[model samples]
Target: MIAQSAARHYANFKGLPKGRSELEESSLMARSTTLAFSGLLLAAAPASALARDYLVHDQKEYRAAAGAVKAGDVIRLAEGEWKDFPILLEGQGTAKQPITLTVQTKGKVILTGASSLRMAGSHLLVSGLVFRDGSAPGAEVISFRRDPRSYARHSRLTEVVIDRYNKADRRTEDRWVSIYGSDNRVDHSWFAGKGNLGVTLAVIRPKGQPEANRHRIDHNYFGPRPPLGSNGGETIRLGTSDESLSDSANLVEANVFDRCDGEVEIVSVKSGANVVRSNLILESQGAIVLRHGNGNRVERNVFLGKAKPHTGGVRVINEGQIVRDNYMEGLAGTDFTSALAVMNGVPGSAINRYHAVSGAEIANNSMFEVARVTLGAGADAERTAAPTGSRLTNNLITGQDGKPFRVEADMVGVTFTDNVTDGEVPGAIPSGLRKTGIATKRAANGLLYPTDPALAAQGAPRDLRPVMVAEVGPAWYPKATGIAAFGSGRAVPVKAGGLEAAVAAARPGDTLKLAAGHYTAEAPLRISVPLTVSGPRDADIAFSAPTLFQLEEGAALRLEGLSITGDKAPRQSGNAVIRTSALSTVANYALEIDGTAFSRLDSAPAFDLIATTPGTFADRIAITKAAVNGLSGAVLAAAAETEGKGRYAAEHIAIADSRFEKIGSLAQILRAGTDESTFGPELILRGNTVVQSGPVMLGLSGVQSILIEGNTFRSSGRIAVANSVGTPETRIIDNHFIQTPEPTVTKLYPQGSPRVLVSGNSIGGDAS
Candidate 1:
């Protein structure tokens, strides 16, 4: 029934069917009746008996009227583009007469360009709004709770659409929808294309509060989220690790999570007493982890992996968590990050660390084609404490994989009973476990059930109850039999005269296939949307201009199977072939150059890649399977233009499986942040060959973790790696340095920074 309401809310607009149009003539009276019927229901009164109605044509009028809105008042936004408008709604209405904010003509009022809404006060309803083609810098697109004031109580946000709201660097913390306060509901909304940082929706528990937030997030569509490659990217997070002990009493039911593989722990339940039931989690990379808190219930959910690697199932931790009646099919994860992982807790763990799983009940669940199920995972080293007083009973597991279960040595005080598995169960399994074969088939009600009457009667049914593929995403998504709606878009082919023209004419998800020939760019190409430009191995791009590419805000550039070379321009000074500026309005940007080459750049200090926007930053930059040779300057130079208090920060820079030869000064090979700001905690230089003539191969400051492994460095330099500020962990291991100078790796501020271990490297004949 709740799902039906969500469907109705999404299909609320009259004469506005998606992707098509039909002109329908109606009298003024009929139009008025339709408009009034869409208004807020006041005290169970009929639509004609509403107190007052105000038509706001623009943001200016909307703002003015929003300040003075009263109970039983309905404000209708006129049809047009409301760009970068920040709406702060504050009103108090009785349950009988709630305040409403809606559109006059649905699907016609488009909100773009950093537009957002912050709802305050109680008994408020915001519905039938569309937010797309924009991003909110350092904030959520729609927030029901603001800092220092949680005013949204008994509020509802329905029929809302937040699509493609992203940041510039993809590292800044933000969300699409943040629900706070008690008795609030977010239903039937659609959230798609949140490729950057932050969750799609988060239910935050206010600090120092004992009462649970009691929010209901149901029937919403959580769409595709690309892997963020770090922590803090989840589809739905109930609470943070800090508030793990707080009872949220949140109910997340009947929602569809489609390909939401943003990071590990997809639907993270960090709080206690929450219920995650009857939902469909499809092909996501992470499982629904009970990371913290206690007494949580995870039941009746469907997890479909379809044989993808890292696709997960329930991962249990903490205490008093129940996992039952769930169906997992074609899951591939094993070991600690396995299909059914009952993690080994750390002894005397704090609130933030992994706590022991006590009083857990894994009962009556069905697993098909799972790689491995385990208990006491990660108990060997990190998580040394075993779970206590846990029961695994009456679960039916059948697969061809021989290794069905792996119980670690340290696991003790576990009771496994009546669990039937047809595969080769481990020898250490408890005594009462049985090996049985169960027959199953699809029943008339569209659910898989055990055909054998005895198996069905024993409550140990073995059935891979697959979710209807057509019923998987947003309610209004076009139904295709046996197709997942979240993974349904196809890239259109684009052909143009030049790269810049192709990028300008192409849509967000279009692919431009370049022919195998040399292409020249007179001016730098500006990219403001996510695009993929690929070609054959023989294709190349030559840059005559000072800068070859200029990435704007919200742009993601991927270049593969191509070579990029710089022309010999003598007059060019202190410029790069590819550069980024801080003047962009968008927050996050991505640049991926793979299987490419950069050579013959004769300019003085020829910086091949320069990302130095003073106040702006990029999320990820990856250069792999490429070669950099015959360059006078550093191959990669990234730093904030301005020094001191205004430096840009980039995250996740990976240069792997590549070759660097005949480079200018080894000191200039890789220059990460300036003396002021830090680049990232993760800078990976692995499986590469670097041959330089100068003193240094890498220089960094204010970094966190640097991995320099499995590389051959042939240099006469003084230092292989140099750091100014003290980093936490720098591993210079497993590298062969030939004909190197005095110091292999040096840390300038050795006292402040931790020591960089220069071991496992055959430097100048002996391991250094």
Candidate 2:
């Protein structure tokens, strides 16, 4: 009976004709006026008068009231901070009136700090709740099932917000919403700021359950998921690789993805027989990858990449995939992230591996100024099978490189007809895309519409204007930007007595001017926001705690014109006086120290001035007009790697007009191996004085570019180039090593003709 009611409700939602049972009152009214509980004396009052409504004040009251809640009952939780509340709304309701678990007033209740909800049983509804500023105790913030034997069907979750519910460690895998069961719908909601390692929302079909879930996810806002820097960071995922052959038949439509640069797959479709249409992707650096699915339809979607780096469209990987009528503009990715990629498949593959593309259709699409449209992409040794029996017809494309499309492998049974490009259509993946000189007309919204009449008639009507996430979510929820800016745009003054509190209250982009006095850092200060601490030259700090300052993700600190003295316990690595957190966000950080002095008391194994946590990196670090005297290890060590893959931390490090006397090596900026697809390992050192800093000053390895000019080294060791994995570009000119009997530069590798440019440097009191 409940399944019949679910079918009837879905039919009613689809505007289908009412059968002999249901009342045909109107479309606006979702429910019929039918009650079947022996009428209970047959009152002519509305269903609300007969239905029970409970106002719960606390968890004990809620637990007491939950058992007695019946069909058509409404449980309204009062507005407050519902922290650590484990909510379970388990009941049975008819299709017309679902058991509602909602807030007393909309947008007023906050569920935070280990709160989770599970809606088990049939015809349940949950709405108007906000999960904010806390992490869930479990893997999911809200699950649609309680246990293995019980789950929610005909359920609806609407008008909700999950904003920045992150664990302190972003590597901790947690999801905002996980859906199971069938005929469920999630709409008009907002999910944002998932910096962790899981998909934001997932339609999960666990093993031993092969039923088609048939979930509808529509009209929601997916906002600002920054790169997790690893896999498993998709915004919406349909199913798992283990359930790839099962037909979940999910529908994802009318959604907006804004700046979701989690991974190369933004919306990962791993289930079969799904419909993905009418969605808008804005500046996300990933594709809607049909990763392990088959017989899926991708149509009428809009990809406005805006020429951002690595933004893409659709990627086809399986059989019977139909991609058509999509309009894309300004995409800037290539190869695997092409605007439209028809990929090669693994031979004799498992269900988890890539299936070969067969009987695919690519038709009636219009692309404007995209980077590439690759066919048979990733055709290596294992994925040697080419896409066969596919039709590429009636598509219009204009590209930046003039050649929009390329064929990687042999086109065995593929056919191309009536396809037009502004550049030459390529014959091979690395080769030609022939220019047809086709004259095309642009639409009013600045996208190319199809010129062929049959292709034009085949296109569906869609709203082509760009959609902002702010338009669909609840009106009270603010649209979150990817990089959070907490600055109040005001300055604050700090004294020695109030330094810690001032640092704690300071926002990003703020400046704290310290008074000229002595201070003691007895407790470690963790600075996670970009702040500047400036003081006069007479100001000095004594460090007694484990590292006076610890840098976190996206944080940058500037120490200006201050003196520092530390007598901390001796440590070898990963324990610098200033260090990034090992569990920081996988994003860039920066540090700048200018006109500062460092003095170690009692020579207690002088700490490195600044070091990064292993596997974390800095975008930039600048040290100018600074004087330091240290005892041992590398002062700036950003050279940690993942199991010696030779990954370095900082992108650009520049030290100019600084004096290092009686200290250790100046900087060890090393990237071990050569992978040219990544960005910089660069350095700039000029006009510095190094005196009596023996053995090493600059330990360079796999550095792409460096400019070492106009410095004086007094009897210090040479700047050694250790690794020749990449063509290291080096320039050492016009420096003076005062009476130092060592060669100025040493190339460690035996690779011939290292690109070191050395000239006009005085070594051992003679100009060379």
Candidate 3:
């Protein structure tokens, strides 16, 4: 972004004062010059003094070739997996002719497994390379500076794909791209599955850096970035708390943010003079938040929420901000996550805290829902200052006629002028926004445009269109998705052979249809991809492995209609029918076992039917229409390492329409008592028939919510459920007990939490 045109664009933007034009000038210049600049940076040398191609096949050769790099020189890497190579390159080139570092062929070179790319030079272009299936050697996947003191200027990274290249632990923080230096660009790359900690892309101003670090990020495809379950999950972040008052002049344009629900702030702008425009947000349950910056513009972006929960448009805070010409619809967020939320600021706030909004403009935008527009958002103690000297002007809002706007602040020093809405909004002046009947039709580009001549011009600029998958990211990426599944659901027939080998060969999302024969498994069946192994109930596996099956943390597996024996399970306790790998300490899990049966050939009597390791936990464990006869372990179990302090392991445990006969104690299924975390450590045991089970033991310490309904317990039964120290909800209804022959009584509630509903059940010969 350090191009001359980019610098001039900032100076040329209309209505922006001297310091405010830095971002606008750079953004419009990047959109117009990036394509032509790509051609210039990538074209072969001009048959002049600087033109040469250095083809490197190894780390040693690349180092030697980089030393001699010059203007218009092409340093090409051989096509294959280059593992653990740190390609730190630096060179100088002219604007007309740049230094090129690329692969022999597009999308063919794989730089994976601790490999990295760092550049510190002028007019450099890095393209057509992939980094995947491994983590970076350090914190950043790619760095614009070779070191802290040196940085790359006026460089470009395009057609590069970083897919599933991550560490096993989700807490390991590392950004995919970290921009430094001045006027650098990253475009047309495919970045996905950034499940680990850190922002997907970050623009940083290292110490002693220039005032305006103009960076351009455009036309990239940001794929499914699953929630990080904590802070530091923004898909793209600009600047930081320390640099809040400085001008970044960063430009983010025409990219597709797909399902990146990592945190409440999708694009956290923490610095000043940045422009975010023409971007499309699809089903991501967060917003572009002007969290700490001033003199920032959020414009021409299309937010298509489709009523998905938590989806938002833009949230404005700080000062001298403009939120304009954006089209938002079907957003279902409120307060801080509202489609357009102007927040209350903390008085005399610190650098990291929210500051008061002054001289802010929210103008010429269109919204289809009332929940989308929220004024005076996030009002609480210590944040008593409301927005002052701000205007919401000439915007169009269409929603329910009577639903009142969320007005938390008193709206001091605020003006609502020439704003139009179809409803009689309670917060806004009724006379200012005249009511109208607005109808819209889909344009050729599949976007709705207003039929009313006046309203049509009030929303986002018509020139901005919804970004398609093809327009962003590398052309050769295998998958393009917002929330696409892990696999394509294709079936690969499993012939008579080693089932382990077959599982390794199968692609992700593929279903392996097992043949009705003896499949030998001498090792743990390691499933590192999403797969479904299906067969009839007659199919069996003679697994002599440490564990029957081991799964990569994010990988999902479905076992259907098969039989397995677990007597060979190791006494050292690697025994698990399906266990997540310990390589990753923590992550969410998806496991399904349907119509499958387990038989132990020996009398071990102690086994783990399904288990989780110490630090790892599952979000949802669903076992439906299955039979675990002669079971020796809990259906699901994990250690409550931090028990009684609030955090229990799993989110949801569901075992439905199944049968458990001759099974051992299920006390370890859920034992964390009085967990404070909401939405789970919940268990749903419905429509199951238990015979000769281990007394139906749910110990004194239990889940937050337990529903044991429509179950038939015969000969030995009682339900003891509660949160000893915390309040819990337990519903035991519509169950039939043939004989109440169990030893323990069916009550475990403590003094604090006594909300257990045990109704509509028959304890004797009657049915309730």
Candidate 4:
């Protein structure tokens, strides 16, 4: 009878029904029959050998109960709020009788306010709990391994939810989940709203451990996350940069990433021999970047961009990578999402740099409505070496217009065969090289798949069904069909022109893209609307005159991915890179500069805000992922004088994930003052590397709150943060002050009011 039941279950698993209710009912029935058979086998054992259950209501009871837990024991947490409770779960259980920690009622037990779990055991399971609306501060919310000789082995975490578990400052670095053990499984979990600075889920392979970290992360839901605007914000990272060469045989499959746009790489594979397959990425602004791995496999995944800008496909960098059997739809990215971007590797590159792509096999992938599919990206000025021994075959690509394949002039030894495309291929490939299999076209009703029979079998498997909510997320339902679904289509490109002409022709929300060239404007360009001007990593823009870009009233500019070089031979005295005029309205404005570089300026600030009107304010100024060098003046300065009776302030300043070298001579890097009536900037200067030539002075007269965390400051002079009113909440924690004197915080109030929190900072040494 048990064999008959098992056969029935296997048959149902292979041919499951399509509807959500039918699948759920079938799954439940299967589990029930299996459990009943297991119970029948256990009936013959002794009563003392039966699995035991312990109920715990609070942290105190949980601690007492955990101590007595043994093999085949189940600890059930009561339906209540576990606030600020740090749980250390340690146990030993056999593979057949694993220790389980679960809630009495799933989704009823809430863990909040620094409540965390650190597991150290083998064959243990933690399931059915919610962690939300709170923080663990400096620690991960869910950690598999404990400190000082405790490590988990063969453990599993299922049906767990970690949402919005942030630090106090929201800028401190702490991961939501850290897996640091061998053969651990984290499946059927949901992670969302991880707003801090770290990977949402990180798999670590410790040094000197011979065994691989063979972890499995499957059937989980990674929900929406706002852009961190910097690095170190991947949804799932296999290994760290230091461990990039290690072999971590991990598997990440059957998951859904729903708008998980945390940073450039949605899922970063840093270690070798990992498999990322059968996942659904929906409307995310990054690719599955194989940053530092070899012999990794990325297959059978689906990327549904819905024509979202910056939504990307697979990006290959290192060698021995295989990307095949995948489906992509509605991608609107250029270099990052070019269907398949084979990056150009620098010669003698380190692990961090783009490594040479050799022995890579990209096959049997299907793309619809994508941007340019490129080979040898990032090769022009960087002079990255072309790929070798890479083969592209059996791919199907269809787009609206333009070239389907773009190959750099330097690309060599890349073989293409049996590829089918509706658009024109690049000129690098010979006309008769490809054996086309299908003449694909888009559906007339705007669906992802084509209605014509000629294109029906071009992409993913024809038997597969479209992705559904039940097939994704924490609830793992068996897929009825094998095919991946197509997403909606939209495309926005940066048109080609001169710098000024492109800017003139662009409307609001358009990105004016510049290529790799030297663009010198005749005069300072006046920007009056919200616009984005972006370029490649190697593009350079120089100004003949000072103040290359001017911001008028109600003007906002997002400068991205460019190298800005100010002419050291000044066109005029006191020339700056960017100058903002005094505001005429009381509305708050902003300037966001990302992935840019400013260098070789004689004595000018990067941003010179001339505040003539007192009532006007720039609300948010965020400069992230930039490199600034050779600045002999302040990087940012509020003009010394103010006009009118009201006050002028620049509030909410964040400069994170940037590098500053040889800065500051005549003035401080950042200079802002607040009068007694108005509040100053709420500044967060985190995760920056500063190599300064002189003392770094922070002139915060009336600042509201300042958080300087995780910054490395290498200087020989004393650093001073002088506050006039002494009312700001200042916290200077976890900063590495190397070869520098101890930082002094000066407050004008003699009563010692509004004291600064200064701890966990290492002075005169490296802090790592």
Candidate 5:
């Protein structure tokens, strides 16, 4: 009975559903009679009979020409290999008569399967086919699942080439491509050793469902991956399962991933909007990570490989993600090992987790030459602690002797201006060199005219004086204003003061204006070249010597204005401070607090200024229009630990219109060590004024593009913007905090932080 005439010819082919299932018919003359019967079979054939040339030598002539395809057909595939069974081509085209299954010539067409090549409905178009050896470890070489006796909704897999067909030692199996359903278009395909992700768009039952969302993955080329499924290098992945079922919208452009293994996630979304741009990633190991989808947009794109230092280059745990102008180079492997990392209130939540990445803008793009940590813990912890506040303007990082590597990492509310670094000047890793002023004599243009040709070519060792000029005042003599006079050699006298008593002695670079009456000195004025030691405006410059300003180890000090104070020892904490010693380059260290004030200097129990070495030359500290009334233990402390490396290395610094009222215990501004190089250890605290400085004003440990604009802090001290350091690039813009808060008032310790851009700030604290 031949199964009762094949069930009466499948019930007359299910009442002639025509092609592309008539775009799911919904009446209207049955979709205009299925687009007038596929436009009368392509206007009455002939163009090689409407191009339907199938030649699959086995599997029963490929399911008998896919049940004799009709509606505007174009199934071509004639030059070779075929093994895995089902090519169930649910043929039914009508959205302008669709149905194109191509691969006419370019040889090698192997679609070996246990269950794939399953196109279940709607305007199908599977182009340039090449599905190889399929091992079906679980199946899905090419799918479009959404069947309930379906009538094709919307299918398309262009340039289709699902490689290694089923994997049976085709060099260790693994190839997958799975699409749920909804206006699909997977263009220019070529997916090698796949699945667990080479291409995936999951959403299998999450309740109310319905929103497989429109899709379009452009310019495909996802190679390499199978050495260990899902390593997270990401070639393409949207929807990793949060199960509320809203696969909303999609569109990934310009694709080109070399060794994708994992981490390009995009889970939960109650809304829609996706657009990943440019694209050109190589050496794949880890990158392109995003989660908890929300109006997404990642721009430019050019990431180069070998991730896993917590795999960076892209990591946004979702909250309105929008990282711009991307260009990530690699270097994040020190091997501490954490495995499958997914931070931010963790769980089995694999990736894309965001509720606060709000409106991102990581601009510019130029992580050049990346790779400084040569053989474990080098370049001092990746230039001090990488990532903070996102916007990090105009980047151009370089540092492997080529010079320019100074970033301590905690960039709060980031907005660093015009950064530039030429490289290699950061020394002190079991190293020491600090002695300026060596002139034995000899130069008629023999090059060592030391005493300043900018310190004579840096190697320093020159001698030859005839350019005398050291008088101090006439605008403090340096060629009497024509510049070039930095301690001109050959004039060794003072030990008893004579030239008008050493011109009222107070050396350094020499600038003792004085004048408004009130002068007392006990012996503390030992600087070498950079000095301001001001007075003149209603004068008062007294130092009963307990330690007023003694910096001797290649000093570069600046102490504007002045006001004296008497006895204070434990080693003279800080009243009129500026000291350097122990191997130095006081690196443009400025502490100008114009109104000039400070009491007891932490009652003299020791440190107020220790000079921890960490330099690339940008800024270490600059308190402008100053005022620090009564400090104890910490008005400013820059710790340089020195282990693997990287904490705070000077770069571009600015501390605006300062004023720290009652300081006790610690921190008005303090930066700890670990900088290798990036030249952005920037700090700009505008219109500053801190009432009770102790619960932190700036405690950055791994600081970066820091800029806390429009400052105002009242009575604070417990982590008031502390740099927790796992990775902090902070940016706390337009700031203002009152009543001295922080009984755990969130200032930042957000796990492995890299980008923090808190817009236009204002907090209330003081409830503890």
Candidate 6:
């Protein structure tokens, strides 16, 4: 066991000499005295494992000293930046007493990456060095050999800085630092602007036997270099490919990221556990991740963006992981922030046929200015089972550029709920305010509203709710931001009848009210004006009133109220509630569907909603609710196209709520035509209860992507969600599934096969 040392802290010191002569003189004096003493010590039995500490100044001396050192010895470097030269330590040491390579000066000491530090040892400890000016093609500044029999066990690398000050080589293979074997600790380090990755822990063989390597990387800073765009590098990574079958268990925690080009990766592993927590990421492309090897955990990180929008976020492929309690923000372009976005399907080749994301938990995260929270779609996903056994809950969210969140409908055991959305406004509401409610389900403490739509009209500051819940009051409102809710009378007020009234009559800034009742019909409520909607659960009363509820056409609508329902109108037919589109053609409704509750009351009939419009009416809708239920005919419905190339297509929708049940033939369904005309449609479902339906709970066709999150499901159906051709991507995750059969959990078809990811859900089903 390594003895724990006090945590090291750093402060910038401006006045440090940058001359080599002084360092050379100091090195000569220290070496001459050390040599004189070495003769006296060698005369005796040389107690304490024949150890020696050499003071190296130049690259030549450093290399010679390292070769001469014994297994249980050390080589301490003098304080100074040594540009362009790397020292490799290929030695062996026992567990009891290991070799140590250290830097005595806490000041600026650099080991330029002229070469690589390849280690093939049983024990090695490296600490307190700044490595810059990387060289060699695809060569890491410091790397270790991949050997199952030998490893850098009980090794510690502390307080090292790797950057691009010396000069960077544009090689795919060269990274800032690389480690092959395990049982190593890399802590309190800084990495910036290197290569594909700042730090990597992978098997060099590409494919090999299962070797157990473990590492701990903590308290590091990873970001881009100065002047921006100089070196587009990624963060840390841990993985092994089929070429190298070796697996490693690693822990990455408490790191800082300012901006990076690539994503942090945790890829292929045989069986291992990795945990990431309490870090900060700002203005970076994102992190690449693959937890396929085994167990992993990611939690408690803060992410922020400046002027530019972040490209991507954390992506998790075939693996079981736990992700929770992280904050994300994209100040511009709403194209950032994804918590646990899964890329590939399951781990094993044959197991992927089930369409499941086995064993993952995503919960309690705050997001803002993100286009889509999750994304997955590809050819490998055909007939594949979406991710399964995941739970999502109690997260606050804001913004909808791409789509808030998406998921595969066929996913099993994914739940979402207990989230809030409060957007920023410039002065008044811009065009398109009324939101549309997507086909989604949820359960518990969810507040979905365009709370302050007008606040962010002309590039206004973002509206972030300070307090998540109202401890004292049963109802909650946007906290005062010093700006009046009405926007100094410049804003108009939202009207009673859905989005049309808000757009036609509202001004640049205004507020509106919504009555509480099954408010579904006004299909596509559009609003071209600015407004706000505020009312008590009892005060506002509105419902999808059969024919009257269908939203008006070509109107930018912004509607907010309580207890909103997306169930299709009560058809004149039999006991089956319309699971498809009951009310269609609220033409051209660019509405912001906010503050609506979606649920199925115990006393209400089961089949109350459906999607028959075939991509008609509901367009550009955003839904936010407190709860939801799936009993009433497919929680939310997507229309199927019958005719036309691209005449009418449903695109850009969202749903958020709690208390959503999973019942009947379809819970959340989407459908479309075969051609490209039916493309470019997306749905983001977040923070809601999702449960099992009777048969085919969710059905879809001809669409782009679907995101599901934070809900609970009962689990008893055929294909918890089913989709058809034209379905580009589907992300089913962060939900709960109980008592579900393996067959009924999830299913997907060809033709627009989506990249299915089932993660972060609590599952209690019979997969067998």
Best by TM-score: 2
Candidate lDDT (C-alpha), each:
0.67, 0.73, 0.73, 0.67, 0.45, 0.45
- Per residue, candidate 6 scores C-alpha lDDT tens digits across 664-687 of 543344442333222245667677
Query: Which regions in candidate 3 have their CA more than 4 angstroms from the true location?
Result: 1-57, 78-81, 207-210, 369-374, 381-384, 398-414, 418-437, 474-507, 510-525, 533-549, 559-577, 585-589, 593-768
Query: Stretches of candidate 5 above 4 Å error?
Result: 1-98, 101-118, 121-143, 147-156, 159-185, 188-235, 238-710, 715-726, 729-768
lDDT of 6 at 125: 58
| Residue-level lDDT tens digits of model 3 in 47-153 | 35658878999988998889988877888899888998888879997565577898887778998789889999888888888998788989998999988878998
**What range of 10 consecutive residues in model 2 has the weakest lDDT sum?**
33-42
* Regions of candidate 4 where Cα sits further than 4 Å from its true position: 1-50, 380-383, 431-457, 465-467, 474-768
Residue-level lDDT tens digits of model 4 in 1-768 = 443353234223322132213323533553464454244223312223676778899989999989988866778899989898898889996555567788778778989887889999887778778887688845688899778479888887877888767764433578889998787877667887765567899997665653568787776788876555335668999986667776788878767888876666899998888888767888887889898978888877788898876688998988799998788988876654566788778788877666888899988788887876878865643435789998887777876464667776355568877677777766688742343434444443223554557546555554333344464444522222211111111113442337877665555456676777777776877766667778887778877766777776446677889988876335445566776653333223567889999888755543222222232346567889988887765556543323321133464678899888776631232223322222335678899887864565344444546788998878745656665432356789998888867777876543213548999998776523
Query: What is the C-alpha lDDT profile of model 5 across 108-214, one tens digit per residue?
Result: 55556564666876766665566555445454456665353443355566555655343332122233665666556565566654423233333223335646555
Highest lDDT, which number?
A: 2
TM-score attained by model 6: 0.46
Which residue pairs in candidate 4 collide? Answer: 464-482, 464-483, 465-483
Q: Write the per-residue lDDT of candidate 1 for residues 1-768, one digit (tens) a residue.
A: 222232233223212121101111111222332234343333223423655677899888998889888876778889988898888888986554567888877677888998889988887778768887878744788888655565688777866778767775555678898887877877667777775667789987767765787777766777777555445668999987788887888877667787776666788898999888767877777788898889898877787788765577888999899998787777776654467988887788888878988999999887777787877765634467788898988787766375678776455567888777767767677464677776778665344556767567333233323334343333444321221211123454433346767767766645677887777777778776667778776677876677777777656677777777776433566656667764633345667878878777655565555544543455677888988777766666664433333133455678889888877543232333323112243578889887764555566554555787897778645445555442235787888878765344555443233447777877675322
Which segments of model 2 are wrong by more than 4 Å? 1-45, 403-407, 429-470, 482-488, 492-502, 513-525, 533-548, 553-577, 582-610, 614-768
| TM-scores, all models, native as reference | 0.70, 0.74, 0.73, 0.59, 0.26, 0.46
How far residue 746's Cα lies from its native spot in candidate 5, in Å, is 9.0
Q: After superposition, how far is residue 292 of candidate 1 from its true place, in Å?
A: 2.2
lDDT of 5: 0.45
